[model samples]
Target chain A: MPRFTAGDRVTVLDLGKPGHVRIPWFIRHKTGRIERYCGAYPNPEDLAFGRPGLPAIDLYRVHFPQTELWPDYPGPPGDTLEIEVYDHWLEPAEPLT
Target chain B: MTPEPIGYSADAVDPSRLVVEGHEGADYYALMTEAIHKILLEKQVLAPSDTDRVIAALEAPNVTWGARIVAQAWKDPSYKARLLADGSAAAREMGYAIKEAKLVVVENTSSLHNIIVCTLCSCYPRSLLGQPPWWYISKNYRARTVREPRAVLAEFGVAIPPPMEVRVHDSNADMRYLVLPKAPADAAERRFDDLVRIVTRNMMIGTELVEPYRDRG
Candidate 1:
């Protein structure tokens, strides 16, 4: 079962694992809504080291407001940024005030 | 030294002649790739015909593939819905069997525009759109697009109105994105081929809009 569904707010985990992680540093600890599930994919970290990549992880496309990502973002207030993140790196986010 | 003609000796002309730029670099990679290919061929890991097939696929032009799809989507709302729902599967309907990374199509509207970038690396929809443009893979584009998309887009000669929101998609993982720019006026009345001419690669990248074809002459 997937950890998150579409429209669910989530925050990317800031945990640093060695070697070949798909999670970018910029989106760590940032809150966003899951746009959609991108299906399960093999763990790239394990696959990079020649291990048999088993138990695929679910990936989700998370959409975040540009303001939430970069404080000084020059784009409009409604401008958004979307990124694909693996399930392990995301956790349920608290609701905004 | 052997006696040579003073006006134009073969060695002198050869030394003075301009050589191809990046020749050594190109040759180095070519040799390395050839060596790898030869070893794989010798071990029967890759058949000789495999290279031919890959070359053929690479050589297959992407001149009208994207345009045709965009035009079709404009003419048919149902097709547009499917394209927005499942971009990869929709592409497969057009005979492009995309088996690697998934594709997501974002539509541009009156108040919303979508642009694609891969900050970590250049992950593009190569199978359907062929190779990405050089500027799309540049470090400047990757870094700036996320920070200030409007400014970067302006450099590309695209100026988005303040009322419109520019959504920048950072393709950080396996999923690729394609911007579905809004169709030009009279798109429904235009012929498919005529509509195709209006869509450009830049438009699909969200750096520009689909302009109506015009004859300057």
Candidate 2:
């Protein structure tokens, strides 16, 4: 079962480890909503090195408002960027006011 | 001052001619792909037929069938609902051979506009849309679209003004996506066939919008 459901808030974590990672730097340390759970899959970081990655991790599409991600974001607050984030990269975030 | 040599103009040797022929932008990645393929073949990890089959899949005629789905969704509300609920299943039911990646179909509305990009690399819905265009894989597009989509869409000749929100999908992992462009407001005035014909590949990729269909007759 996934930890977060659609509409839940999440903060993409910046683990700071160096290696193959699916999460982009732009999305790191950002708050977003769970768009949808994309099902579980072997950690790509492990798969990159030919490891078995036996235990799969859940992946969810997180939607972040452009204004929060960028300081000078010119678009409307509704403008969002959605990306797939693994369970490990996401943590529960407090609801935004 | 001496006159120019026989049949020779001063611009004949214009520094441009010295530029090497056939080596313009990116040859390194091509070399890297060939090297990796060679190793895979040597290790027996990839069969020659496998490469051929993959190439065939990429070049197949049924590649850009997103328009078909778009057209069907426009005509049938039920189908559209099914597509939104499970895009991969709906596309597969329609006969699109989805590879390992799943498809997520996003629709455009008067209040929202969607654009697609892969910030880390070029991951596209090739099974449904054939191959992504050159710009789709270019480093500039991969880097810029998620940063400022409206400006990028404008560069792609689309203008999203006011209350209309721009949503960018980063197709970076596991899932591929297709944009279901909203039909024109005057769609009822046009024939279904022409509208389908104009549903276009770029519109499905979210870079362009379908123009109002006009009768040729």
Candidate 3:
């Protein structure tokens, strides 16, 4: 079972599938602050196979800036993106350089 | 930019044949099969296997259909009220079913704007609006839409004026959402289909709002 909570910083782990993974391509390898804790839900990987009992994973709503995720994101400087991610996909954000 | 080819299976009802608008997704075969099996088990159908090809054809994106509904609501006040009251019934009024999908309609008020996201996974309203966009399901949009919807909208070329509120609607559970954008000015007389043409999928998702074309050309 995955264990993470709101306010915890995490990095998305790349699963290597281009379109299949729930994590968006733009935010891979980046880190952000967790904004909310969406309770455990069915892991999508299990649902696609019509299987059941796959342990529910805790979901964290993470916030990141558009500029941080994209090199040429044409938006205001303060603009940011927040997404909900499963625990398995995230590791604690590495210390700031 | 060359648009991606529209994927459709043979034998599915032609989109034009249906009074409703929009194409379903290509992967609908699996879900349709499951639906048919349930129907057959209930003695509603004589030959479950007969629907094999139909199931395949049922696949198409649902955004176009969603756009149509938005346009219709914009043109008709009563319809709009019904939609805000009960989205599923309103969709059924237009001959669509919620079917294995939950429906939620987020109204955009003068001060507040609403956007939808599936943070954990891409649990979209596939039955009503078809497949979600590649970006919508992307971790970036999902993660950001909730916490920073205004910023996401800015990236999408939408800027909420100061003092305007931005409310992000997270569709994480069984309930899926559609944004009821504030109708643009001077759009009171446009036909439903024509109005739909102006309501892009991004607009339905709340990243953008429909605007009048400065020129037809």
Candidate 4:
């Protein structure tokens, strides 16, 4: 089962490691809404080193508001950016105070 | 200095003695990959027939088919919805198998604009779209597009109004994406074939818009 579903608010994990992981640095630790659940694929990090990447992981399409992503984002308030993120790097976003 | 050794001018060096060889930029990597391929083949890990099939798939024809899909989407609302919902599946139905690496179609609406870039590397929709433009894979484009997309788009002669939202998608993860630019204002009267003719490679990449077809000929 996937860690998240469409419309779920999640924050990317910020684990620093030396690897061939697909998670980009820009979206690390940032919160976003899962736009949709992209199909699962083999773990690329394990596959990069020629290891057997068994147990495919789910991928998600995540959308983040431009304002939340960049402090000086120079676009309309409605602007949004979307990126694909794997399940392992995503965690449930905390409730708003 | 002794009158420079008679007949010993710099240009007098034997033309045959100098090894003038053109270098391939990817020679080393190509050689390494070839070695790996041969080993895999020897071990029966990858059959030669499989290699041929994969190569054929990579070099498949229909490099400009992306434009055809875009044109069809523009003329058909239901098709466009299916494309946005499942780009890879939509492409497959159009006879292009862009599987494994998923495809996402981002639409450029009236109020929102979308551009794509692979910040870490050039992760483009190669199966359906063919190779990306040289500039799309450049370091400058990748770095600047995510940070200041409007500025980069402006350089490509795509200046968006301040009120319009410019959303940039970084193709850094599993799924690849394509930009579906909104049809030109005068497209209502244009034929489908005419619309396809005006769709340039850059328009699908979101660096430019769909230029309306002008019947000059």
| lDDT tens digits by residue: candidate 2, B20-130 | 323355689889999999999999999999999978977883533777788778877898999989899998777876785888999998778888898776788876777
lDDT by residue (tens digit), candidate 1, A40-94: 9888879989987779989899999999988877777888899999998988997
Which residues of candidate 4, in runs, are more than 4 Å off? A95-97, B1-27, B34-56, B61-63, B211-217
* B1-217 per-residue lDDT for model 4 (tens digits): 5686543222343424533233347799899999999999999999999989987887673446888888888888898999998888888877777854878899987777889999877898888877787888787788678767888988988877766777888888788888898898877688998988888878888888764223223
Candidate 4 chain A TM-score vs. reference chain A: 0.90
The candidate scoring highest on TM-score is 1
**Cα lDDT for residue B135, candidate 4:** 82
Residues B1-217, candidate 3: write the lDDT tens digits: 9996553222222523423223348469878977778878689665656666556545654677888788888888999999987788898898888885446677776666667777766777787677678888676786567545667777988867645555555555445678888887756967767777787777778888665223212
Comparing 1 with 4 on DockQ, the higher-scoring candidate is: 1
Q: Cα lDDT of all candidates, in order?
A: 0.82, 0.81, 0.68, 0.79
C-alpha lDDT of residue B166 in model 2: 89
Clash statistics: count for each candidate: 0, 0, 15, 0
Tens digits of per-residue lDDT for model 2 on A14-96? 87655778887777788889999999888889999999766999989999899888878877787888999999988899843
Task: Write the residue-wise lDDT of candidate 4 on A1-97 in tens digits.
Answer: 7767778899988656457767766677789999988878888888989988878888888999877877787766777788888888888896633
Report the number of the highest-lDDT candidate.
1
- List each model's interface RMSD: 15.5, 14.0, 8.9, 15.0
Q: After superposing candidate 2, which stretches have Cα over 4 Å from the reference? A: A95-97, B1-50, B61-63, B186-193, B212-217
Docking class of 3: incorrect
Model 3 chain B: ten consecutive residues of lowest lDDT: B7-16
- Candidate 1 lDDT over residue span B1-217, tens digit each: 8996554211233423443322347788999999999999999999989999998887574747887888888989999999999988888887775655988899998778889999876888777778888888777788789889999988987877777778999988888778888988888888989988888888888888765223222
